[model samples]
Target: MALASAMAAIAIDTLLPAFEQMRPAFGLSADSTQLSLTLTLFFAGMAVGTLFYGPLADAIGRKPLLFTSLGIYAGAAVVGALAPSLEVLLASRFVWGFAAAGPRTLTQAIVRDRFSGTAMARAMTLIQTVFFLGPILAPILGKGLVALGSWRYTLLFGAVSAGVLALWSLRLPETLAEENRRPLSFATTLAGFRSVIANRTTLGYTLAVTFGFGALFSFLASSELIFVDVYGRPSWFVPYFSTMSAIAAGVSIANNQMLRRVEARPLALSAGVAFTATSGALLAVTAASGGLPRIGVWILLFSLANASMIGFAPVAISLALEPMGALAGTAAAVVGFCSTGLGALLAAITDRAIAGDVMPIGVSYFVYGVLALACQLWARRASKPAHI
Candidate 1:
């Protein structure tokens, strides 16, 4: 599951350093924001593709779908590497994102099959800690690759890595039992979605994760601009970006440790509070400074804010999936769809607004943070007894 999750992150995060090179290679203006579209489009594809893969996983079992998704993802990566134009590359990337939905969505289903409650949350955190390692190291690896060759090599690297991971996945046994499998049908899929929607707690946490993901996506989309354009530290971009992701990785690891003593709900709510507070402070500093703050302050507070939110994912996902034993794939699909789809939307909006100033990104962080907190509170209230 960790490697599966890392596939998507590696595809996007690794290519971040390649953004500068991509524009020129594709005959784009140096200042074009279109390069960022590659990321958003990849996400858009995931949102669509999960709808198919999730239901198929539930119907056919995980192993076959895993092979299918990874094969397509690998092929798409090769196409992206050989793409002769920006249009062709982006189209290939969208397909790459689409095919990736298999691993991205089904991994959660596989985990939910084995565990529930706090243990499930713990598993997710531990997996995510490993998952976060991809982002921490991807840039350094990507930067090295770019230094040695070009951005196309980075895409080719992803192709090769994904193929290897696909083969590695074959060794694992199927988690979804034959008796538990749902027949593939429109009515069955709809019924599963309806069940997810009727559960207020599931719906609430799903939205919380959605908005939370939006904030993170916004930060990621603008990060290159933040470190490279705003701070004028191109070489420092990977180091600082890795530091930010490292904080999230550390928080997930800490959350895994704390899960032995803590429940997921309160911890998630508390994380939301901390995340909102961090973003609020970031907004204040950015407003006072006109736009960019001192690089040191910005990086510290931004990383901290992002870290707080990162801890919430495992908790929220576990809570949402607790009541979804029979429909883990479909449930995960809805959650992934909302989070990735809405997140990509937020990133696109933030990308357009940032222009050259990063104040918009700061504002976006605050806005999404507050929205996530509100959803978290509502979820808590909705989950509680009236007597309490």
Candidate 2:
């Protein structure tokens, strides 16, 4: 599951290395160069598909959806690889994202299907470590491939990877038992969604993770620009961005290792506190200096803020969907939809705001920190009644 999802993620990150080749091939502007990224994320919020995929999983089974979705996703990759125009490529990316949604939503559902308490945490940890490879090695890998040829081959590689994963997933086994399956009816679907919306704890945790991911999108959409255009770093700076991201991966490892001792709530709260405080102070410092802070300081602080988030996202996601065992896909759809959709919106807004300005980037960091802090406090409050 993680391999499949990460294969899809490589479509986003690895291509960063080859975007310039794609730019002319697609005839996109500097602004529109990111249109593929934006559409990929925007399609993430397309919840209409999951409304059916979930109940369909309840009806036919997870294996069919898993394999079928991968097949379609691979098809879309081929479409994207063959695309001759930016419009066509963007459309292909949108379809890829829509198809990829099943794996993203269902994989979490699979975890919810099998375990709870600390066991779920352990499983997510293993999945996350696999996931880390996509972002960690994708750019480096793409760079190697681009050295051999054009960007279209990157999409070709992604298509082939998806094909391999589709074959591999056939063996993961369905975890949702026959008796546990709910009827595939509109009433049941509505009730499942209603339960998710009605539960304050689930809703709160979802919101926190939503903003957390939104902040991630904001960082990613701008990080390359900040480094290449603003910092005047060498062309080799892409590796540095990937490296900072890898260093941040430690927070996930630490969170997973400490899960037995830490409990989800306190770890989430503490990470949120540190995340918001670190980014907020850096923003204030940047503004105080007339929008120019030391480059090293800016990178370190935002990098650290993101590091803090590595600990928060999975825990909050697990807590949110715990109650809706029957609605695992439903809850996951809501969370995944909101998380990626809002993330795209935030990234678009942040991308346009910065439009190549350091001040806007600083302000965005401040805004993201404030939003994350607000969501965390809301989650903290929502948890209070559980203890009562």
The best candidate in terms of TM-score:
1
Q: Write the per-residue lDDT of candidate 1 for residues 258-337, one digit (tens) a residue.
A: 98887888888889999999999999998999887887888778888889889888889888888788999999898888
Model 2 residue runs over 4 Å out of place are: 29-52, 234-236, 384-388
On the 0 to 100 scale, the lDDT of residue 355 in model 2 is: 45
**Candidate 2 residue lDDT tens string, 158-232:** 788888887787678888788878887888878877888888777877777777776777666666666666676
Taking all chains together, each candidate's TM-score versus the true structure is 0.97, 0.92
Per model, state how many residue pairs clash: 0, 0
Residue 365 in model 2: shift from native, Å?
3.1
> Which 10-residue window of candidate 1 scores lowest in summed lDDT?
379-388
